[model samples]
Target: MNIQDKLSPTAKEIPPSGIRKFFDLVVATEGVISLGVGEPDFITPWHIRESSIHSLEKGITSYTSNAGLLELREEISKYLETGFSLKYSPQNELMVTVGASEAIDIALRALVSSGDEVLVVEPAYVSYSPCVILAGGTPVSVPTFQKDDFKLMPDALESKITAKTKAIIMCFPNNPTGAIMEKEDLEKIAKIIDKHDLIVISDEVYAELTYGKRHVSIASLPGMKDRTINIGGLSKSFAMTGWRIGYVAAHPEIIGAMLKIHQYTILCAPIMGQVAALEAMKNGHNEMKKMIEQYDQRRRLIVKGFQEMGLSCHTPKGAFYAFPSIQATGYDDHVFAEELLKETKVAVVPGSVFGEGGKGFIRCSYATSYSKISEALERIEKFVTPRLNGTCDKVI
Candidate 1:
């Protein structure tokens, strides 16, 4: 029997995450200062972790309801309303997922059918297109450019639509670029969405991390609440990545379909994680604010560092990434990333892995410590300065 023949074609066709490839590479190499992965370097807040520990101490080990602990669902509902002015019923319209990642997967699985096309904003999270493919849908890339601060233009979105377009998956305070859409910008896209009658899977995992302006949920727009699936989690905001807790809010019909899939596939999110998430919703804001402040400082530092080194970099409005163009180095993204890692022992992700519009850039994460970010910047400068100055010798 050929083992390869027994696997689903889609599962086989799914490529490994390019981010993970570099992440693993950094792990294998000693003394490398990595700014590649998007994960926050902070430990989970003490109060949230304590809540989970208390739950486990009480032997609350059994599964909750399929949709999750009703208390958690209620907290999520309240959080969404308070944070983004979106209301969802805990009983029928909300679900606790293992993470925003799972929320995204089940949303696509629930909404898309074979032969359907789902519009994905390019330079997108690495998981979106693959998850759409896994759900048996065609993943259509709707490109957004650096010149636009990576915002998805209404015209660009409208151009990707067809009768077969079932939905769109969008991440705001986007990964790799950290681009955020303001309220008016969202209104424009929301109008286009309404005109096309398209469903939106709005992944606002970084909603709390926006700087300078608040994140506007497209679902909050008039007539959009019914058609959008809102996804978010405790990972980025509460520094709870290991907890794997997230949720989806939508119309009860859509939630019911997603719940059915969640029931069969996940049964319930981990009880401890759900407990942590509930605490996060209720009291994690203070800790999140402190972390976000530090990230903002580092974001400015890294962006300035790249600019001083003669790399064209956009100031990220949210999230913890700095995307700088390496086009002047006469290297494609992969070559630049690999050469930087080899020469400086400083790892960053090549932009090509993110999709079409990312080819000339590289993503450096500012989620690590400020000192490490500064050191990495110095190392990168040392490595790139000679090349930028048209010299071939090492200065140090």
Candidate 2:
């Protein structure tokens, strides 16, 4: 049997995520402190967890409506309206998915036809390119620079557009980089999108984790709601990754199309997750506030620690990751990450794993306890200082 022939070309061609490979290595080793994966260490809030248990106790364990439990969607609608100032009808404009992962996949599958191009700003979340490719769309990576604080510039986006360009995946409060697109920046992208009439798959999964400012959805911009599919989840903001609940709010037509694919593929998001998400919508704001405050303090400490060690770090405005430049260490990102794990026993992801413009940086997630971060910092300083001073021949 020709197994290779049976595999889809896209599946065969897509490389494994670089971040996961290093993570596998680190996880297998003893005594390695990981800041590699972008996940909050906190447990899902007690009330949300209790809601799921309550649902199960009530025998509400069956499959939900294809579009999700209507009640959950209604709660989500109200939550989005209250939190992000975005409004949409729960009945027609929303669909719950297994997670933001599925929301991303469904949106791309619905909007992108064969050979259509979807622009992704790099260093992006790992899933965007593969999701676009799997949908038979070409992933056009627009490299955003550190000097620009990784913001997506309108001119850069405009230059990448072609007749085949169908959509743009906007990842703000971004993973690995922690850069959030401010309102003015979002307005610039909105202007470009308006000119091209391009659809937007806005991933706002990290919206609630912003440091000092409120997260502004691109969908909130003028003329954007109709063209934007807002993707969000309970994963980052509410520490609900294992709960596996996510949703999309878009124009009814787009939501309908995504719902069709989701119906056939996923049927419904987990019943328990839906119940939990509904509870989260009702009572998670205060929890989000507390977690954000903790993350803000850790965000500052980690950024400061990296700077104090003479590594230049982008002071992240959102998310709990710090992307620090490794150029001063005289090692490429992969080499630095590998050596750091082996020598210091502290694991972080190489930025290049995210995409271009990440070659000389590494992403350190500050989602763990402050003590863990402090220990990691100590090991990092010991490992890096000698390397920078030329006392160490090589990192490993």
Candidate 3:
């Protein structure tokens, strides 16, 4: 019997994560400094961890409501209002998910049907396209470039829409590129979304991590609230990734559909995680701000280091990753990334895996320590300089 023939075609078509491909290599190689993973280097704060521990001690372990714990959802509601001026009803319009990842998955599945097409903004997070594919929808790339600061343009967006287009997935404070769409920038795209009558999945996992500008959710803009599915988490901002707590907010009917899938697949996010997340939402601000400050310092450091090494890097406005162009070294993104790992034991992801316009660039995460980032930059510079000098720079 052919096991390949027995498998779902969608599962076979999905590619493994480009980020994880290098991350796995880092794990296998000894003494590699990983700028590959996007996870924060910070531990969960004591108060948040203690709250969860205390809950466990009090025997508070049980399955939450299919939508998650009411108190946590209410706190999340307040968080949305305070942070983004966006309002969501905890009673019907919200759900606690496994991660922002699962929220993305279920939202796509809820909106996309066979023959439907979903617009994925590119140099995007690797998961969005695959998630659309798994939902039995066509994944269309709407490429954003470095010239535009990686922000999606209104013309670029509207051009991708067709009669079969069902939804668009957007991540601002974006992964890989670290690009953010300001309110005015989002307003243009919002008009196109409205014109097409399409649903939008807005991933704001990096909402609190911005440097100079406050994050403006497209959902907060006029007429966008009901058409948007907002996905968020305590993972990146609050350093609670391992806890697997995230939420989705949308129109009650849309959320009800996601919860139906959530009920069967994941009955609820863990109770301990919900309790810890509540503490983070309520009191984790100071700790989170401190982490953001350090990330800011690291972001500047990494960007400067790239420029010093003769690679062009856009200073990321938010999030902990830097997307640097390696075109100067005369090597494609994959070649540069692979040889950098093999020669310098410094791991970074090739940007090509992120979809259209990602070629000739790489993503370096600044979420690690200042000392490690410094050392990695040194290694990367040494690795690339000779290549720039027209030596057999590829020779390591």
User: What TM-score goes with each of the models?
Assistant: 0.97, 0.97, 0.98
Stretches of candidate 2 off by over 4 Å are none
RMSD of each: 2.1, 1.3, 1.2
* Residue range 1-396, candidate 3, lDDT tens digits: 999999998888788988889989999999999999999999999999999999999999999899999999999999999989999999999999998999999999888899999999999899999988888889999999999999999888988899999899989999989999899999888898998899999999999989999999999999999999999999999999999999999999999999999998989999999999999999999999999999999999999999988999887898888999998888988988999999999999999999968998999999999999999999999898888888864522
Best by lDDT: 3
Residue 82, candidate 3: alpha-carbon lDDT: 91
Among all candidates shown, the one with the greatest TM-score: 3
- lDDT of candidate 1 over 1-396, digit per residue (tens): 999999998889899999999999999999999999999999999999999999999999998999999999998888889989999999999999999999999999999999999999989999999999999999999999989999999899999999999899999989979999998899999988888889999999999998899888888999999999999988999999999999999999999999999999999999999988888888988999999999999999999999999999999998889999987777778878888898899999999899988998999999999999999999999888887777854221
Off by over 4 Å in 3: 393-396
Give the candidate order by descending lDDT: 3, 1, 2
**Alpha carbon lDDT of residue 330, candidate 2?**
84
Q: Of the candidates numbered 1 and 3, which has the greater lDDT value?
A: 3
Instruction: Compute the lDDT for candidate 1.
Output: 0.92
For candidate 3, the lDDT comes to 0.93
